[model samples]
Target: MRVVVDGMGGDNSPQAIVEGCVLAQKEYGVEIIITGPKEKIEAELAKHEYNKNAITIVDAREVISTNEAPVKALKTKKDSSLVKALDLVKNGEADAVVSAGSTGAFLAGCTLIVKRIKGISRPALAPVMPGKNGPFMIIDAGANADCKPQYLTQFAQMGKVYFENVLGVNNPTVGLVNIGEEEEKGNDLTKAAYQLLKEEDINFIGNIEPRDIPKGKVNVLVCDGFVGNTVLKMYEGVAETILSEIKTEIMGSFVTKIGGVLLTPVFKRFKKHYDYKEYGGAAFLGVNGICIKAHGSSDARALKNAIKVSKVYYDTGVLEKMKSAFAEEKDTLKIDE
Candidate 1:
């Protein structure tokens, strides 16, 4: 499989991105096309020893910043690394596109340039997070801050297909994030969404309280972007804080220091569970082509893993499966509307 990467889009820029692409090419045996200013990209690439035939470069003169307006940047910056990389997927020159760039720009570019699958109202951002059971995914993890009831239903359906196909979960349990497990809990949106989710042909598991998320009670957690984003950030913050506190205590004294050394492996394993790099990036579900939104601060390892994740998405044929499912549900969807 071939993946088009934005080599100039992240905080680490060409260096981290290039190294990551090289690692992915070497380890995964996938062809990579890195898009950016030719000189900058090549400079970092030359530092590493990799299979020359497996890596290619495409020149893009512009770079989009996080502060720039997403829609405007995408429309005006035709030669930008972000836009050019996306074009590769739109034109079928690549199976997937990976970017550690502006999240807003990535979402806009995919929705406008690559487009969304038929019958999908809005594409959702679904990212897998470490759960006690393994890993669970949160759909609309900051895609649409505001959504209709139907949108949540769609997120549930899309999240279900993704978890099942990509993560190998069978009939993944779907849950609506709310204040309580009761059917009548939540604002008008969640309450309305609860009813819709119940009617859909899915493994609806009812509501999921935010407190229960870490327990991995459900495989797919569906909510509007606002709530999902809040949950994701809070979870990350809590995990980081806990780890930090643990490290501080472990090094406080000679005895503790010895204990730290003895338990280093255990701590490493625990940290790995919450590390964002482990999962690579979040998928922009419902997009016509594969588009993965890597973390903006992604390092070389994270970028490599993101590419691997993209390959799995491509190989699983999740896009085609979503298209078929949505197409078949189009008629029934209208009735429910």
Candidate 2:
């Protein structure tokens, strides 16, 4: 599969992006087209030994900075690296696009350029995060802040499709994020959403509390972007804080230091298990084409994994299955017209 990457988008820019492209190409044997200034892209590529035929570069001089307004940048800078990379997927020149750039611009470009699947109300950000048992997905994770009850139902449906097809989880349990497990625990939105989800054909597991989320028993958790974003950020923040504190305490005294050395392997495994790098990027689900938004501060390892995501997405034909679900499972996937 051919994937277009935004070379000028991330904090590390062309360096990490180029390195990741080379690594992804070498390991996955996927064609990569990187969009950025030709000179900068080449300078980084020269440091790595890769096949010239497998990796192509498209010169896009403009770049959409994080400071710029997403919509205005999209309208003004048609030749930007992010926009150009997205265009490759939109125009059928590439199978997917991956970026670690401005999340705003990337989401806007996906919705306005690549467009949404027919009958889908809006595109949602679904990030597969590390949980107690394994990885769990959170839908509407910082895409649309405000949503209707019907929107949450759609998120659950899309999340269900993702788990079943891409994740190889048959009949994955779906849960709505709420304050408590009861149907009447949340506000009007959750109350209404709970009513709608139960009628769907997928495995609806009722309401899931934020505290119980990391347990990973619920495969897919659906909520409005506001709640989803809050949960995601808090989850990340808590993990980082706890890990940092553990390191600090371990180095505080001789006794702890000795114990720390003994448990180094366990600590390393724990950190790796919770690291966001293991998950790579979040998919912009409900779009017509694949768009994987990598972390802005990602290094080569994370970027390589993000590119690998697109390949798996392509290999499994997830988008086709999503379309088919919308077609055949019309009642379940639809929001009120």
Candidate 3:
């Protein structure tokens, strides 16, 4: 698989991003295409020994900052690393795009440059989050801030495909994020979406309350971007705060410190389940091309893992499946894309 890396994006741009491309090129053997200022990318590449044939460089002088408006950035920063990397996918120069740049800019570029699936209403930001039992997905995580009932229903379908192909889940159970498990709960939006979800040919598990998310109640959790974003941030925050508190209590004194030493291995194993680096990045589903949004502060390890995700996406042919899924329904389904 040929994957493009935005070498100028992320907090550790060019350095961590470039190092990550080398690691993935060596381990996964995916052709690495790095986009950024050529000299800067070259300097970073010099730090590591790699097969020159496996790695390619594309020079992009402009950069879009995290604070810039997403749409405007994509338009103005035409030659940005983010834009150049995405262009490679659009032009079939690469199979997938992996970037840790501005989320807003990245999403905008994917939707505009790479384009959405033929009939897809909106592409969802689906990330495989480490759950209590195992990893699960929350679709439309932050892609579309506002959505209709039908949009949420489509999210479930796309998410189901991902669970089966990528996560190896068969007939994955799905649920709508709501205030109550009962169908007659939540605002008008959830209530309407609940009914639409039932009509789709999926393993719909009814409404799933926010409290049930961390427990891994369902494999594919569906919600609009606003709610999904809140759930994701809250889950991450609570887990991090709890781990921090545990560390503080573990170091109360010499007696507790000895106990902490004994439990260090256990803690490491437990923490691994919640580490964001393990998952790498979130896939922007429904796009015509493969676009992954790596964490803004991704390290070399995280970057390598993100490339692994791109490989899984390519190897599994998940994008092709998604295309076929909506392609057949275009005639019967009145999708107003």
Candidate 1 is scored at a TM of 0.98
Candidate 1 regions exceeding 4 Å error are 334-337
lDDT of 2 at 332: 52
Among these predictions, the greatest lDDT belongs to: 1
- Model 2 poorest 10 in a row by lDDT: 328-337
Cα lDDT for residue 54, candidate 1: 90
Q: Give the residue spans of candidate 3 off by over 4 A.
A: none
Kindly give the stretch of ten consecutive residues in candidate 3 with the minimal lDDT sum: 328-337
Candidate 1 lDDT score relative to the true structure: 0.93
Pairs that clash in candidate 3:
none
TM-score of 3: 0.98
TM-score of each: 0.98, 0.97, 0.98
Error of 3 at 311 (Å): 0.4
Cα error, residue 330 of model 2, in Å, equals 4.3
* Cα lDDT listed for each candidate: 0.93, 0.92, 0.91
Cα lDDT tens digits, model 3, 1-337, are 8999999889999799999999999999999999999999999999999999999899999888899999988988889999999999999999999999999999989999999998788889999898888788999889988988889888998999988999899999998999998999999899999988888989999999898899885899999999999998998789899999999998899998999999999999988878888889899999998899999989998999999999999999999999999998767554755
